[model samples]
Target: MPQPHGFRYEELADGAVVITHLERAAGTLRGPRAQQFLAEVVTGDPQLVMARWTGNYKRGNERTARNHPRNRH
Candidate 1:
């Protein structure tokens, strides 16, 4: 898969993390979960982290699944 792009995040004053994809709101992480995400994001790849957090990452089988006859509809 291509490298995940268009993912961004912002930290809020109340210890919340707002994640966005392609400039659109995707998810908000608060409290301990937000802290955990922030730690992981800085330590690793931001794009991958955001994609995973936002649940917008593409699985390897997407092309195969999309080409399948059952999915054409």
Candidate 2:
């Protein structure tokens, strides 16, 4: 389960930006959510994703813990 557990999709005038924990899934909005998230704007216009990124939230939390020295473990 190293992959992203959640995904955030954004639509631009010409393409989309999908931010995830593992990788970015840039592609044309030829699917459900893609169309749903970007209504009329892309209404049947088909969305195109431009880029995606993997966020290291877990690593970030670890760094935070190291700095704060939390006893979570």
Candidate 3:
């Protein structure tokens, strides 16, 4: 899969984190989650971290799973 890009985040006055992907709002993190995100974002790859946090990354199994017999409509 390709690398994740265009991910950004903002910390709100109420200590919530708004994570955006491709200029759209993807998720919000509050309380300790927000704090953890801030810490990890600084130390890790921001785009990858943001994608994972927002549940936006592909696990590379979509095609196989889609072709599975149980998943057929």
Task: Sort every candidate by TM-score, greatest first.
Answer: 1, 3, 2
Q: Report, for every candidate in turn, its global Cα lDDT versus the true structure.
A: 0.93, 0.42, 0.95
Pairs of residues clashing in candidate 3: none
lDDT of 2 by residue, 1-73 (tens): 1333444455656554343323455334535655554564343322222122232324436556666746555
Question: TM-scores, in order shown?
Answer: 0.79, 0.26, 0.77
Q: Any idea what lDDT model 3 has?
A: 0.95
Off by over 4 Å in 2: 1-3, 16-52, 55-73
TM-score of 3: 0.77
Better of 2 and 3 by TM-score: 3
lDDT score for candidate 2 against the true structure: 0.42
Best candidate, lDDT: 3
Per-candidate count of clashing residue pairs (backbone under 3 Å): 0, 2, 0
Location of the lowest summed lDDT over 10 successive residues in candidate 3: 54-63
Task: Give per-residue CA lDDT, model 1, range 2-35, as digits (tens).
Answer: 8899999999999999998988999999999999
Q: Show where candidate 3 strays beyond 4 Å.
A: 59-73
Distance from true location, Cα of 43 in model 2, Å:
22
